[model samples]
Target: MTRSRAQTRLMLAILGAVFAFLYVPISVLFALSFNEGGLPTAWTGFSTKWYGELLRNADIMGAAWNSLIVAVASTVIATVLGTLLAIGIEMRRRKGRLVETLVFAPMIIPDIVLAIALLSMFSLAGVRMGLHTIIVSHVVFNLAFVCAVVRARLRSFDWSIVEASTDLGAPATVTLRRVILPSLLPAVIAGALLAFTLSIDEFIIAFFTAGAGRSSITLPMQIFAMIRFGVTPEINALATIVMTLSLVMLAISQRLNRGSLPGQ
Candidate 1:
């Protein structure tokens, strides 16, 4: 009985320590966001002044708008292409390893390498680097994510039903429209949400691809520039808001997926 009690105590102690380690920093950050004096070292009661300042800051709003455009465009492109790619690849009886590798290449490749490669390609082709370039770059990686996510949804997909529809004189278009797409809807939306979150938060690629102007800057780029000037109360408010948006999107994606093993 004593040994069991000691083990329970030890387990609780370890879990308690882990929880504190994970959350203490977040707790501090949340507290600092509301600090009236705009200083982390000392709290001078709660205030929403920093958030108000963030709203009134035109430069910040410009960057935020740019990010929204990039994220929205990328997500839309990725969702369409990724859904189609998933269907095409899964329809085959034997999946090609080469095709799989090509689709997933962006996920594993170093971001710096992709960034430099895109820059070199654009420079050679005389494609002006700006918000459009950022959108194109985001689409490249975002498409990979959407494809992978939608592919997972297809693994356990009942192709026999599709065959049955076709065997009943349903055209390929009909099978896709009535049979395939409805089943993939959940994953399609999940992938789009995931892609949007990634594009919104992506910094390194956006920073490199955003050309030589503050005009085309994204929110992450703005945040990076702000951080270089040191921490401020307004920054805390901005960070809190961004983090909340990301967390909410993540929760939605998780809810869409039951996390079954692919093909199981």
Candidate 2:
């Protein structure tokens, strides 16, 4: 009994240490965002001035709007294309390993490598780098993610119903609309939310594809520019807000992917 108690205590200690390592810095940053003095090491008092400052900053607001545009556009495109691709792959009986690898290559590739590759491809194609370019790049990155999510849901899908619908003389379009799509709706929405979160937080690909202009600058790029000087309270506030939004989206996506409603 003593030995088992000692082992349990050790496991708990390790778990506590892991949690502290992961969240202590984030907790400190969250706390400092409300610090009136705006110093990392010193806490004068609690204030929401930093959040207000973030709202008042024109550059931050512009970058945020740009990010919103890119994320929404990319998520929409990726969700549609990825869903179709997922359905195509899942419906095939003789799925080749090569085809699967090609489809999921983006998810496997390192972000920096993919970003540089995209930049090179754009340059070779003589494509102008702008918000449009960022949107395309994000679609490329997010496509694999959306496909993976939807494909997981498809694995457990009831294909017999689809066959029955088709056997009933339903056309391909009608069968897909009435049968497959409705069943995949939750997964599709989950994938879209996940893709939106990724596109919003993504920095390397957006940075490379965004080109040289304030007009195309995204929130992550703007945050990078600010942090180059040093971390400020305003930056902390912005980070907190972004992190919270991402967590919320991810939580919702997970719930939907599990085919459950929130608070259920």
For the record, the alpha-carbon RMSD of candidate 1 to the native fold, in angstroms, is 2.1
Residue-wise lDDT of candidate 1 within 39-114, one digit each (tens)?
8788899898889999999989999999999999988998999899888988888988899899999999999988
Q: How close is every model to the real structure, measured as TM-score?
A: 0.92, 0.96
Q: Which candidate should be chosen as best, given TM-score against the real structure? A: 2
Off by over 4 Å in 1: 1-19, 259-264
In model 2, which regions exceed 4 Å deviation? 259-264
Backbone clashes in model 2: 0
Candidate topping lDDT: 2
lDDT of 2 by residue, 122-225 (tens): 99999999999999999999999999999988888878999999889999999889899999999999999999999999999999888797999999999999
Global Cα lDDT for candidate 1: 0.88
Quick one: how many clashes does candidate 1 have? Answer: 0
How many angstroms is residue 154 displaced in model 1 relative to the true structure, after the best TM-score fit? 0.8
